[model samples]
Target chain A: GESVGLHLPTLSVQEGDNSIINCAYSNSASDYFIWYKQESGKGPQFIIDIRSNMDKRQGQRVTVLLNKTVKHLSLQIAATQPGDSAVYFCAENWSGGSNYKLTFGKGTLLTVNP
Target chain B: DVKVTQSSRYLVKRTGEKVFLECVQDMDHENMFWYRQDPGLGLRLIYFSYDVKMKEKGDIPEGYSVSREKKERFSLILESASTNQTSMYLCASSSSTDTQYFGPGTRLTVL
Candidate 1:
């Protein structure tokens, strides 16, 4: 789904299951993309990032897939844990911008059930 | 590891009063930014500083200003705070080429 505002699309997963969060960005020129996890009462924490050149990147138990043609990004989490319950944000960076600032999407609150 | 620190986790302010939010980074990053998070509005850029003494306005910078006197610190200023400004302010820092490291965040309530 598109990022309309502060509303983040959510993904619910059972413990020990895999979870996938999706985001669709607006800028085609964005060269880099990053995903973040923000727990309640805390700020957004960096999870993983991918450069536009690469369609897919893997991390420790996590993977990021980029579809430039669709301007979409997804985060895959393995073996979901309750600790994984938090709002996840996807950010895009266009190197052409003056500040190279990242544009953040609303976010997806992933709820992992134990 | 990059560590970004904010002065306050929560704050209260009155309308028409000035407000300041401070952010510091230990990574000696050259770039720092300020953003506001609101319900159903996502995170919007307020301002950013690319280097000491250099600052730029982001998309929604009409009511905010920024200062970066040193490479490690960035401050956001509200000339005349308004209730509409009530939201979660996040501070972030990045080197010339790296991911942004965020602070815990500052929740400001304007009444």
Candidate 2:
């Protein structure tokens, strides 16, 4: 079965440094991808998303890059802060009907040191 | 803001007990979903409802069921809770074409 997965399970960065989280998806039919941030004791919050038509999309201090050929996706965060410490997940939405259900990666735990 | 709320933040139930987890969304979205998150397992969809009185089984729906009596509410039910059912359950809602907004998840422990 095709699945989405992260390259790293944990990442540690210092404050003000740039951070990157990587994901690889196996389903070639996936047309939409999203990044989510989950703080401790909370649900995952939507961060940014990109459609397969575009390779890159940017949101407030964050960018999502997609590589359809390689079936890879990545999320970049700028000026990492202590508050940014959390688990980040990447989800792939395959092209289909109106269900809009997503397949999520296991997630990467990000730790930002102040 | 799209706010999705769950009935409880933490719940503990005995084995064989019936468990119900309620979720409500204020955005009046047409789609709602239930997922269980476990360590190293990511998020597995339990069930989803696209409209009132309509339901669909998701990837992992063997031990769970759902109810969507109203447009704003969706509920997940465990017929017979077991220790293996313990996990963090999350609820989300979205329009047919919109991104999903999630609730503060409910941590369930079946002892």
Measured by TM-score, the strongest candidate is 2
Query: Candidate 2 residues A39-94, lDDT tens each?
Result: 99899999999999999999999999999999999999999999999999999887
Error at B89, model 2, angstroms? 0.7
DockQ measured for candidate 2: 0.88
List clashing residue pairs in candidate 2: none
Docking class of 1: high
Tell me the deviation in Å of residue B36 in model 1: 0.4
Tens digit per residue, CA lDDT, model 1, A3-113: 322234878889999988888887778899999999997999999999989999999989999988987888999998999999998898888767668878888989998
> How well is each residue in B1-111 modelled by candidate 2, as lDDT tens digits?
889999999999999999999999999899999999988788999999999999999989998999999999999999999999999999999898878899999999999
Q: What lDDT score goes with residue B15 in model 2?
A: 99
Report fnat in order of the candidates.
0.81, 0.84
